[model samples]
Target: MTSLPQQTDKKLGLVIDLDICVGCHACVVSCKEWNTGGYGAALSDQDPYGDHVSGSWLNRVHSYEAGEGANARVVHFPKSCLHCDDAPCVTVCPTGASYKRSEDGIVLVNEDRCIGCGLCAWACPYGAREMDVAEGVMKKCTLCVDRIYNDNIPEEDRVPACVRSCPANARHFGDLADPGSEVSLMVLARGGFDLMPEQGTKPVNKYLPPRERPAEPSSCGKRSASERESTADATGFFRWLDQALERMG
Candidate 1:
């Protein structure tokens, strides 16, 4: 069997900013659109407008509620293939179709070799793998490999479509192997945490910490931008005045 690329101990992956994510589902929708229409066949939709409507999606967004009482908060977690370092899906594959890359640390599928047994899907805990009904093969996000390498596409737009369409700019794509990369920097600065680290998959992707709100009461009711600015300016003026009086005394 051909070995998957494991270059220089560097793994490429995504670092998602949970603080900026609004749970808009834009990433989910765009991912569906691109994967459905790209080199991969349309992502299998089991039932449309039916009672049990669920389909194969490489990515899915989950909204979670946590904490108790005053400290409680809602977090929107977008789940997808972690492309784990120890991918069970690859080991379980009867064919060598599912494999990881040594050069870039990307997990990819060989659609031509897949038998459509769905065994790989069962092995994945993150539910990152998907089966293409049309092609009778399993499919998952290639991280837009075709587009990312296409010379025709612009350099700036080489990243995945989901990363491009995100209005909140919460998604980032780069080589995790490079410690100084932007994704790595943001991960360190914002304290990005992995999901299910105990599983020992060592997922390439990371999620930023949830926003921390202060204990102070939030401003209620409608207030114009100008009014809010005026209030802020007055507050600053009063603070400066107090400081000056203290110095004089």
Candidate 2:
């Protein structure tokens, strides 16, 4: 039986897989291509070749190292607007342009009403919002609303540009409100975590946890049992303790 459209509101959103993301920055490029040229506003880059290079991106990939010193690990986090249920960004906007939709959990900026005060950017702890210098207005991900709703685009290609362009397939778009939805299932199965959950953004977007690699065993491989030491001149204290413990056991 065909499911009624109203039965599940298409509250499309993104799920980021930290485990599989290679930090290739493909999604960043695709976003730049679509958004820098598309309807909202141009994502401005201050200087293409200058020493100080800064720009607006609806999406940004951040690389981090976990643990300390030699045992440290790398983590690639792709940051974007969470489109939160309790969005501080929306409420802080003095002009009332930024708002959360009841139809879908998407937080959107009404470009017509935005006054470009940039208070929303300051309000956002995730640094998801940006000001388009060229347009002199704030800009953020629209979740490809224009493309998703357009009749001309193929249904398969109607997803947000970031999800469509992800080389690692780390980004997924769907309704999180529906328990049966693919995004919902994936989040449940993976135990995905919210960034800075204490902030209480109630972000619609979820990030899959980083997969843990097996720890390498310590390199103290020498032992008296394995190798005969004629005089024990070179043996360390741990080796002597190991020999004593082995005999005691």
Candidate 3:
């Protein structure tokens, strides 16, 4: 069995804002693109473009409809490794392949030491770990460890690929343990929460809850003639015309 670090100097992790994630899957694509070639084994897609296509991915976005009527909205949740402080996956590894870094608190797998055992996957509560069938090894998010500490890359571009490629700027990365860090402040201000605190994993990543929507008509009722017209204005010409007409009238 593997043992965890006593403590880490910096708790490097991500702070995700649920309010602005548009379910674009940009993070997912960017994560796969970078990790496939940069670190670990290549993420393989079995029978791609076929009916039963399946592939290994480090990040995934899930859509959920919340509330009802006027408050109903789709919540796009982006999930990956949390790099827990007390990582169950690490402790469950028989060969010591799974370990948490005492330097940065990043949980990682040593592919060479791994015996293609699925114990890590079963131990993780977040469903963050995935097994690469082709390689016969378990794979997971490394938090872009290769990119963050690399002196080769520019300092400004050291964040994880998902954080850099998020179209809505919904993802943030930093040392979460530092109270003055941007990620920590964001988490504090937004009342960020853990996914499954009850499990006692103590995940490093935090998620900002969705903002409250203004009280208004339900989606069914809100689609008035003007709203329909606005939707029909593919290029916003009619929208501008309507605005101008309203200003004049």
Which candidate ranks first by lDDT, i.e. highest?
Answer: 3
- TM-score of candidate 3 versus the correct structure, residues matched by position: 0.87
Please give the TM-score that candidate 1 achieves against the real structure: 0.82
Candidate 2 per-residue lDDT, tens place, 1-249, comes to 111122224456889999899999988888888888875777889986899998889999999988875567688888988877677888877777887766776778888888899998998989989998878889998887777777898998888888999988999998888889999999999998788999987778999987776664333233344454333443788778767977998
RMSD of each: 7.2, 8.1, 6.3
List where candidate 2 sits over 4 angstroms from the true fold. 1-10, 69-71, 217-249
Candidate models: Cα lDDT each: 0.79, 0.81, 0.92
Please give the lDDT score at residue 95 for candidate 3. Answer: 95
TM-score, per-candidate, Cα-based:
0.82, 0.81, 0.87
Model 3: pairs clashing at backbone N, Cα or C within 3 Å: none
